[model samples]
Target chain A: MTPFSYTRAGDAADAVRLGAFGGAKYLGGGTNLVDLLRETIERPSALVDVAGLPATIEEREDGSLLIGAATRNAALAEHRAVRSHYPVLARAILAGASAQIRNMATVGGNILQRTRCAYFYDDEGSRCNKRSPGQGCDALDGFNRIHAILGASADCVATHPSDMCVALAALDATVHLQGPAGTRRLKLTGLHRLPGTRPDLETALEPGELITAVELPALPAGARSTYRKVRDRASYAFALVSVAAVLEADSGTVREVRLALGGVAPKPWRARKAEDALRGGPATVQAFRAAAESELADAAPLRDNGFKVELAKRTITAVLGDLAGVAA
Target chain B: MAIRINGTETRAPADPRVSLLDLLRETLHLTGTKKGCNQGACGACTVLADGERILSCLALAVQFEGRSITTIEGLAGQDGMHPLQLAFIEHDGFQCGYCTPGQICSAVGMAAELARGAPSAVTTDLGAATVRFTGEEARERMSGNLCRCGAHNGIIAAITQTYAGAAL
Candidate 1:
């Protein structure tokens, strides 16, 4: 790692103030940032350590779960409240990285973790728009197996690699941010930005802003949720295609459903069409297959990743079927 | 920076950029913890903080001030080896032994979690307050600790045999 100055922030204000200085990065967990620094992909002059912030897991009066940004992934997964109430979130965290990485990775760091695009990490020689703006996206044409098929631009096609964020999107989780502009709340679904002309800007978070916490609202009664991740290996590998689903079944009919896909989109791909197909319909495997096909109808897969469409469709069908069984 | 390692409090130069892995191996001379990947991708530098497994490579030395840390060296008692350590030896749970320190420390923490009835992702009943420590459960919990030596079969067998008769 390059030499850099570090200051442990006394409070959120101090973190923001320190971060407002040019070439400053908020250090949470350091699982991703420190690695990037070592590779010279990120060269922040100073690091504002925000790990000591008082933010932690708490239950709201309205019965929603509030997760502090600094809350470690392991803590969040094992929290009694999280395990009982928001199990989808727990499942997502469980499917991520590994036990050791989860212990050091924070919720804020998980959200802010850059894409795992191989080209982006190739510091020696590679064209990556996310790494260096206006350079180019090498993955667009070469070895685009894991590239995004939804909400992608010509500048970049790298898909978001987080399993936790896909569940958050399906649950409509809210991101609570603190910065120089005081406190602000944004929907987690809108947290990521599409790679338009400016592929460099990845998130809605402004410079100097810190993610304070994420709030998960209560789900409807009879809500059954599941997160299914498909990876090359059984463990310790990034997802090839993952699905997060929450379904409400009533008397064998799907009353409501929310679905989101990871590893296939620049952002979490919310299966709005699939959800619409299932709502108020008879819960059946055929219906799930139809819904899954509808969701992937517009997927434009690259040469090598054409199999992803079929794999994702089968994965989604299987997830819906499993949840339907539980509902039954 | 002050930290309590293996029941002893020690101090190091206040270098915030130094990783806890470096502090243990370089500053404290606790060479039991190996560095496979300086990045957090590998669990070769796993250690315990307050009995919880954490990647020391990703952890800053400054963040662990005053916290109790335990490495593989602390596993054995003055008289003999810890039950898990002995079981590992009996089962030949390692080859080359490069990833042993991290694997053993991680298993120590994981075994504790099992005793506490932590539910893993593969747990069938999420509503079950307690989970059984079956071979599958052990493998799922220990999935983070990779052994390039391909001793996973022996490692899993060792942990299973050790905890099989226990309450967990």
Candidate 2:
């Protein structure tokens, strides 16, 4: 690791002030940043520790969950309110790294975790545009098994590896951020950007901006939600294809539906068309299958990831069927 | 930086870049905590902070000021070993023992979580305040601690036996 200065921030203001300076990064939990620093993936001049920020789990007046930025993943997953109301989020967090990692990983750090692209981690193996701008991408043709099939560009095909972000996008969670300019809120789905021109700018967070909290709105009554992640191993492995779905079936008809996919796109892939197709339709296997098919119609698979198209479709169908109370 | 390790308070030079794993092993001579991956992926350097398990590999020594830390050596008492430690010994829950400290510390924290009614990802009822310590729950909770010796079956059996009669 490179030599750097470290200072503990007193509060959010102190963190923002220190982070606003050039080549300074806010440290939270240090689960991802520490590893990145050691690997030379991230080399900041200074680290401003924000673990002491006054953050907690609280319920707003409108029955929404407000998760503080510094709240540990373990705390959020084990919170009574989160387990009872937002079971999908809890399930997503539990499906992540592990009990020990979850204990030290904070909500803010989880949201800001970088992609697990092999090329990006390798400083010399393959030239990654995300790691070094304008250098080119090696995952475009080499070992593209885990590359994204949707919302990808010629410059970068790396997929987002967050299970919790997929669930948050499907639930319409809001991220509250504070920067040197002030505070702003962005919808979770809009927070991420497509690899349009600059594949390096992954999130909408400005420089020196700190994520303060994440607010999850309450779901409708009688809504069934689930998060299914498919990986090579049972635990402690990144997702190969993950689906987060929330469906409401009223009297044999689909009332409302929300779907988002992970490990398949540059950002969380929200199935807007699939949700529209399911709304007001009969809750049957045929409808679920059709929705899943329509969602992946525009997927552009790489050489090794063509199988993910079928796997994602089947996973979505199974999840939606289970949520809609339909079975084979 | 002042921190408590294994019931003893100690201070180290203000070196923020030193990882907690290195501080324990090199500075304090607590070499029981192994460094398998040097990253957070492997739990070979697991330790207890205020009775909760954390990855000391990624933890900065400066961030742990005034916190209580426990390693494998702290598991035994004047009388005998902890229940989980004895169970591990009797069950032969290790082969090379490189990851034994981490497994023991993680199991200690996991047993506490089970006693506190924490649910695992495989738990069917999320609303259920109390989750039973079934075999599946134990497996899912201990998935983070990897053992190359393939002693998982024995480890699971030992943890089950230790927590079987407990209220967790």
TM-score, each model? 0.96, 0.98
**Top candidate (DockQ):** 2
Candidate 2: TM-score of chain A is 0.98
Whose TM-score is greatest here?
A: 2
Q: Model 2 chain A — which ten-residue stretch has the worst lDDT?
A: A319-328
Model 2 misplaced stretches (Cα beyond 4 Å):
none
DockQ of each candidate, alpha-carbon based: 0.65, 0.85
* iRMSD, all candidates: 1.6, 0.9
Question: Residues A1-328, candidate 1, lDDT per residue (tens digit)?
Answer: 7777888888888889898988899989888887788788998888999988865888988889888888988888888877777778789888988877787788988998899889999977789988889998888889888888777888988888898999999998999998877889999988999888777899998778899889999888699898999998887788899999998888889998999999998888889999998899988888999999999998888878888899889999899889889321
Please give the lDDT score for candidate 1.
Answer: 0.86
Docking class of 1: medium
